[model samples]
Target: MAQLQLGPPPQQQQRPAQPGQPGQPQQLSPQAPRPPQQARPARPATPSDTPPSGQPDASRDQRRRALPGETVAPAPDETVIAPPRQRITNPTAVFSGLDKITGRIIAFDVAIDETVQFGALQVTPRVCYTRPPTETPQTTTFVEVDEVTLNGEVRRIYSGWMFAASPGLSGVEHAVYDVWLTDCKQSAPVIPGQAQSQPPATR
Candidate 1:
């Protein structure tokens, strides 16, 4: 009975532990989640952005505040007004009257009479005549009095400068002649069967 060896069985007594040992809380092992860091897209508000208080930036204040009478629009080539010119009140006079034997007669006839108020201009009347070394040399001729027959009768006649005709046919009769009277503008009216041509002597 003294030969009973029990040394191998005594190794089972390695369990003597008891003093504040609570170790079981380290769980972080699902490591495939690293894709959530993409947050950067916020920049689109410019006109220099941040002008809502008194509201002023319409491209930096271009000077437009004038509402009292308001008249500012004339610069395309700028030329407001300048057009009204043509005025002549009394201007037309040519006179002469002396008839003891047809010596000098041109007393009044130079016409242009128009009155429209703003257009159709021409008002001529201011001519008191007679100035030409006159005493007697009769040969003066200038006739144009186109039509005046109510009882005063003076029908068409226009003949200028013939002064005492008869220098080669025995017709002698002369005095002191020097006549000049001119105020002219004529379109038509001198036809008395028209035929008196002789004008080609210029030297």
Candidate 2:
């Protein structure tokens, strides 16, 4: 018989199976699990982002500083000055007299010539007299006229007449008598028929 040597009974060799497949359980390792990631903190504000506590508001300070060389525009709340109110007095004819009358108020009728068309007529009456000065007359003279209210009512005075001129009177209208006088001086009596014509250039 030939020498037959059996090293050992034929050992059955088993092959390791692949993991994560049907009927195969996955093998576990000894490594530790990783931790969750944390979010970064927000950056703090710098000096440029926040103004100092002692400083004024930025917008207001800018406006005030801009006013030195530049004109600061007026605000809507600013007050505006209004023009003085003008009252119409002496509407018709201006009268004058020679005597010194004081506190004498009278109403007079003026007869404007209707034949000749007076172009843009203007009349001025002044009481001329010399009086002793109580105080030294200042170089700058200021004249004020005292007004007399009629029956506690205000009447519109024109250039000369105490009341407004008659609406009917016109350049072609003749013999229209609507003139009146008021607030005459009591001490001076007006010289009647002593009226003098004034040149148109005097206006």
Q: Provide TM-scores for the models.
A: 0.17, 0.17
Show pairs that collide, candidate 1.
Answer: 93-127, 136-175, 136-176, 137-175, 137-176, 137-177
Model 1: per-residue Cα lDDT over 111-164, one tens digit each: 333111101111132222222333323332233323334476644332233222
The local distance difference test score of each candidate is 0.36, 0.34
Looking at model 2, report the run of 10 residues with the lowest lDDT sum. 137-146
Local error of candidate 2 at residue 94 (angstroms): 2.5
Instruction: Assess candidate 2 and give its TM-score to the true structure.
Output: 0.17
